[model samples]
Target: MNEPRSTYPFIARGASAELFDMGGGQALKLFRDSVSDEMIAREADASAHAAACGVPTAAATGQRIWDGRRGIIYPRLEGATLMDWISRNPMRAGWALDRMGEIHAVMHRVDGGTLRSLKQVLATDIAYGPAPDALQRAAIAYLETLPGGDALTHGDFHLGNVMMTPHGMMVIDWSKAAAGHPAADAVRSEMLMRFGIGPSDWVTNLWRDWAARRLRRSHAAASGVSTRDIDAWRPVVALAWLRARDATGRTPAFMRYLDGALKQAGLPFTG
Candidate 1:
């Protein structure tokens, strides 16, 4: 395949992809060369699945290869992200969160079909993470004990991934979409809201805690999923996040949360 050489200025960039302006209100999500073809196909399939299931999301135009890079084209919706909306209307943060919960619930109702398993993903991350062998074994064992579900999980669902267009809200970024229990998905979302902020201080930590709690409560209420269900996945999600950070050699205060979660789950952690 010929390398994609375009003068179209990049409008945005993420961890693994760059959004290039495609004329006529469209954008190309060009991924890094490191991304595998399977990963690209998985994302494209998930995006289409979400749309077919009645979830609000941008439709993938088609998969393309340029310069050995892969990407999907999608319409460029005009609106602010949920985060930007909340920033512009701080007093309506609760409303924004509630909307987020509603969208998540809708997503979880969809059947996962041929999507990848969330449990398997967790197991893989645990195996590769810096956790001690004992902890890794215990985690994988605990994961086996959990019940399975066919719900379509937006593995990386968060306020930022939601966009508020004039037509309605549109979800983006299906890279982590998976087939699994909704509770696990909810837990992951809550964890990201709680600890994904960079370089946290006391005040920031307090604020994050407050926001995370509200977000969790809002999601639980809207989705009719119990707090217990979501909490059950907390340890697993925390370990995954810790492992990701470890992979990058960054030790953040959130490691304490992972330790606490493991203890709460009755897992022995020497590290």
Candidate 2:
């Protein structure tokens, strides 16, 4: 580990923070830079919120500085992230997938657990931008027909976000947390899993199938999301991609999605 022993650090490399291997299996997640304060705080906030809601998670029971940066000291979780485990366990894929759907539903009600720095601003700065008269008309019309139901969105939940532990599994990374439409979050999540699994094969399809079946069984009204729902969020998510808002390694494809989304929503790509 690059970090020193006195600080007792290990490395976890959060999307916005650098994790160091602390002594005796503990870990310290330090800010990569000031730009990461929001992200760093997001982890702390989500972990605490999970505890408050009685969700199982790594106990972030301490704090300290390491590698010339400030961070939280969390009890180092044992075992690989769920993705690692899933890679070698195709036989258990079905049960694992069903478990993920339950996790998603459980997590959706978390208090602002789906909140994010970029998402809240996206609606104001990008999605609802002052467009040409024609574009504005299109968006307004689309919104009128769109469904409205808010829930905690994990912003970027997937198997990778899940950590397998001796006790069970735990969720991590709250930078994408937000309170908003549930399907938007789920669709974005499903897309993230797409690279790992295709539309027809792999765990992505399995999870989607499981989630769809679960939703159908669910009492909550969560059935309208489909290719249509993804198309709905695509223009804005595409703009986010074009602007390099996220490091999801998917800007080109998302922009491609933008054109398709425009066509699906009954408009030509003005940009």
Candidate 3:
């Protein structure tokens, strides 16, 4: 099919050589400023797969070339972001979180019908990929030894990745989709919540404490996982946190958080 003739409104762009626009009556992700073609293609592939699973998303409507970069376009999404709306309606706080949890649960169930795995994602080379072999080996040994579960992981799940609209909540960004233990995803969400926007000091503290307790409870409730197993997985999530920071350069905040994770991993902390 020929690409849409209407120029989409420029909504966003990423370092990976893409400029996204919303003028085609839907959001369009065009890869122009891509750091690498592989990253854009990986995300596009994952987006297609995720859509196949009945996940809410802008359909892969068309493709176009811009500034010598290939671009894939999806229909524009409709609705106010849940995060944005929540600021106006504080009463929906609990409901928003509950809704968030439900979508995530369904997403985890979409793990099947694909060969995606955390190992494969980790193996992908970034500008400063994954971690040293010691980190990967240690993490793999731990994940391997643990009692496993079948679940889909959004790879990168956080408020920033979720959008709320009249239809419902939808997920964006699938560059890191994989099949993995939900607990690991849970742990990562908790880590990124710190990097989130908004939340006054008191409110942030309240949510952090609430989230921590929730995680402890979830870990306790998960079957067949001993304290030692969870402890071992600790490094996996922490290392994954470091991997994210490394993939993107260490922002001031990221560096600070890595210190906490490294301190937990018993590695010499770097900032």
Candidate 4:
């Protein structure tokens, strides 16, 4: 692991990165060595774009190096994540799901100009993934058949990414933001909600499934989009997610979920 610079104290840690309290209401998001400079730039640009489009987001101050690791400076806001709220107040999970839908609706209405293409990203993932060449070609072909649009899609939208702040609910992590069909974005959320990485008890899985369905309904209503449309992208989204999890070499269960999703989409499973 790369050592964190002493300028800030450790705040939290995630699978791929670490957060440090930088004082002055700011935080440093130091990334692992595997993260490339280009990836960081893409995330920064996407964050700026989301903020400009009226989506609540952390204020990205600038980028700096900490102990030879690349990091971004952000104004750390006070609030619990939607996931935290759900876990603490299970009875009110419905409310949290509704809020998620409302916020996501606001995002889909905006045009994602010149940011990045969701199609291209999926195509690249498939090409580089462990799947056989035939499966990769089929997935890419399926992606091409989908309708295109200019809507802003948070490529990794899920409960954990939405931070409920004093101001309001704000989004974090713009590494996967892209311009494409809203259904593509919606399907990605569904997949993550249904089968995320990490261990979980049966009860937790049940609650997650319920919450995921609620989220889908609420998002469809708020955005005036149909679940049928979002569901159509399920297969392609699953394949792309499989490539992501495979790269991490974790979440074997999630990999299985993707395989099932692929089969459901009428594509051959290549796990």
The candidate maximizing lDDT is: 4
For residue 12, model 4's alpha carbon misses the true position, in angstroms, by 1.1
- Which numbered prediction scores highest in TM-score against the true structure? 1
lDDT of 1 at 71: 82
- Range of the 10 consecutive residues with the lowest summed lDDT in candidate 1: 245-254
lDDT of 2 by residue, 130-210 (tens): 345566555545554555445656666777777767877787765666666656666556555543232443455555446
Error of 4 at 221 (Å): 0.5
Model 1 pairs whose backbones collide: 3-67
Tens-digit lDDT string for candidate 4 (100-195): 888888999989988788888888887887778898998899889888778888887888799888887888888888898888888888777877
Error of 4 at 89 (Å): 1.5
- Model 1: lDDT of residue 233: 85
Off by over 4 Å in 2: 1-11, 21-26, 113-119, 124-150, 195-235, 245-256
Deviation in angstroms for 266 in model 3? 10
Off by over 4 Å in 3: 1-7, 13-24, 32-34, 120-137, 147-150, 195-232, 246-271
TM-scores for every predicted model: 0.91, 0.70, 0.70, 0.89
Q: Per-residue CA lDDT of candidate 1, range 86-147, in tens?
A: 77988987777777887888898899999999989888998898888888999999988987
lDDT of 2: 0.58
Error of 1 at 239 (Å): 1.2
